[model samples]
Target: MNQQLPLLFPNAISLTIKREDLIHPFVSGNKFRKLKYNLLQAETQQYKTLLTFGGAFSNHIAAVAYAGKEKGFKTIGIIRGDELGSKISENPTLSFAENCGMQLEFISREEYRLKSELSFIENLKAKFGDFYLIPEGGTNALAIKGCQEILTPEDAEFDYICCSIGTGGTISGIINSALPHQKVLGFPALKGDFLKEEIRSFVNKENWELLTDYHFGGYGKVNEVLIGFINSFYQKNKIPLDPIYTGKMVFGVIDLIQKNFFPAQSKILLIHTGGIQGIQGMNMKLRNKKLPIIEIND
Candidate 1:
């Protein structure tokens, strides 16, 4: 509901950032939008428990945990990779999820891979019984409905709407709700040729474009330039951006803007998907880089 910062370029064109990151301290950003419909569906079905998946620091897990607690439903988090409880007392996000009464189930990468199959989900359902399952990142038809609610009629018209593609749920939903005249662009954070097809299959939208070049590093990996940009962006605008999602998307948006990809007089909207808590561990890795030297001709 607060006024978000807008960046202006040449002519009267401008870029507006939807401050979804500020949606809540825990239930923040697109996570909230993505979870909105899932929660309603769970209630409608009279399901008392909600089960979902994510990594140790996953914002999706955190959001679901919080939502479950607030709405009086039991929550479970199926974590990717191995357990990290031996390493530290608590990673902040996981700790928050635990505090919200989410039962954590850490699984191997191979097991997590089978998560999408009905047989695998049925195995869990047999063990837990009668629980509603929300997919990782809450990307589904219901989630799309929730994300569509984030857009307001008063918002400026734009030819293209850009968002970071994670599981492709948010952008798919945005594409589903957007006018035919608008183009939805997704900048993938992973390195793979299959994501475009995956998104197409998920959202089934034909007016979407995927830009794959901006992921300078893979997911959760940040370089010096990204860190510098994150710091400078905060210094200039007092906005906090996580290195994983929004930071990468913003970096991509800036790159595209600099390339004159969008007309100078066109309006652009960048969805700020929230993942701030994940950045807590990025400082050391992002700061430990040696700069390359450039030769000067005298």
Candidate 2:
């Protein structure tokens, strides 16, 4: 569902959010899109188990856990940060995955980088037996295929479609489906320009642009100001945004609106590609630092 933002801008620019987050309580938004066809393919091949990679507080990890359980496939999460193994009970995301029946294997960040290599996957196959491997961030070809369905016929009216970028899979799909007159803007959650190549591999269009200014210090890094913006944005909009992805994208859109970066009367659609599950984990970190926290972590 798409809901218009209540804010009035000087340029008469309008903001509307595509509430993909409401698609599911657990496996919501882009996670749902990315996993949809992959899960179908797994069953088509008769795979009994699903395997994926993520970090301690990864929304992907949490979503896969619940989605696997719901779909009746055993799930394994190879998480980054070996130290997180002992602290699973204290971490909201990891604990949720565990409770959802996901077997968690914590590994060093160095080893995590070898995730795309064939030797590492062969070793995993030897240890865990056969399983359907979903890449880290769930950004494979099938996942991109799933993401292409995010836009519908009604979305053609919007001048700009914006979303947060993680592995570039989601935006790649948007870029593929967006009308030629529409520009898709991606706000990367991490600090890097390599995403251009990642997105380029999946899409052939040049209508998308990555706005890198609103990361707020890389993936999983958040400050009091961001937390405050999230809190207030929620209070006014009754929309919950996770700190890592959607929040930053929304912030960038509004900032651009204020700066007159868009022409008057431009209609923008912001894709809320669900990471609300990570809010609790982020709030835990905010409390540890005595920073201002988001109002809606539930």
Candidate 3:
């Protein structure tokens, strides 16, 4: 559903949000889109086990676990940070995945860096037998195929489409399907230019650009001001924005609007790629540091 935000911005610029978070209770937003075709491919190949990777608060891990269970497939999560293996009970995300019957294997950060290496995958196959593999952020050709369906014909009226970028899968799909007149803007959760290549590899269009200023502190990092913005945004819109991704993008878009980055009367659409499931985990971190936590209806 497209929800027009009531934020009072100058220049008569319009802001609307695509509520992809409502896509599913567990496999919400881009995860649902990325996993739709992947799950189908796994079944088509007659795979009974699905294996993927993620960190402690990873939305992909939780989604894959729930989606696997729902589709009657065994799920395995190769989690980063070996220390988290014993702390599963203290971690909301890991605990949720475990409750959904996902086998969790925690690895050291050093070893986790080789996640995409062929030898590392071979070792996993040797231990777990046969399984369909999904990348860390669930970005793959099939995932792009699924995400491409996020935009509808009605969305063609918007001048700019904005979304959060992780592994570049979601925005690539958007860039592929976006009209030539509409510009797609990506706000990376991480701080890096490598995403330009990652996005370019999957998309052939030049209608998109990345706004790197909104990362706040990088992936999974948020400060008090951002937390304040998220809380206030939800209070006004009654829509929960995840701190890691959607919140940052929304913050950036609004900041740009106030700075006159966009022309007058421009219509902007924000893609609310869901990450509400990570809020409990994020709140736990906030309490440890004495920072304000993100507030939502949940």
Write out the backbone clash pairs for model 3: none
Q: Model 2 TM-score?
A: 0.98
Number of the top candidate by TM-score?
A: 3
Q: What is the lDDT of residue 63 in candidate 3?
A: 98
Residue pairs in candidate 2 whose N, alpha carbon or C atoms collide under 3 angstroms? none
Model 1 segments more than 4 A misplaced: 1-8, 202-205, 284-298
Q: Across residues 1-298, which tens digit of lDDT does each residue of candidate 3 receive? A: 9999988899999999999999999999999999999999999999999999999999999999999999999999999999998999999999999999999999999999999999999999999999999999999999999999999999988999999999999999999999989999999999988899999999999999999999997899899999999999989989999999999999999999989999999999999999899999999999999888888877
The C-alpha TM-scores of every prediction are 0.89, 0.98, 0.99
Tens digits of per-residue lDDT for model 1, 1-298: 4344556566566777878888887888888998888898899999999999998678898899999999999998888877665532447678888888998888889999999999999999988887999998888878878887766665538777888878877887788777877888888877766777666775655988888887777777667687778777776667777878888888888877787888767777888888776765454333345432111111
Give the alpha-carbon lDDT of every model. Answer: 0.78, 0.93, 0.96
Query: For each predicted model, how many residue pairs clash, with residues at least 3 apart or on different chains?
Result: 1, 0, 0
Report the lDDT of model 2 for residue 97: 95
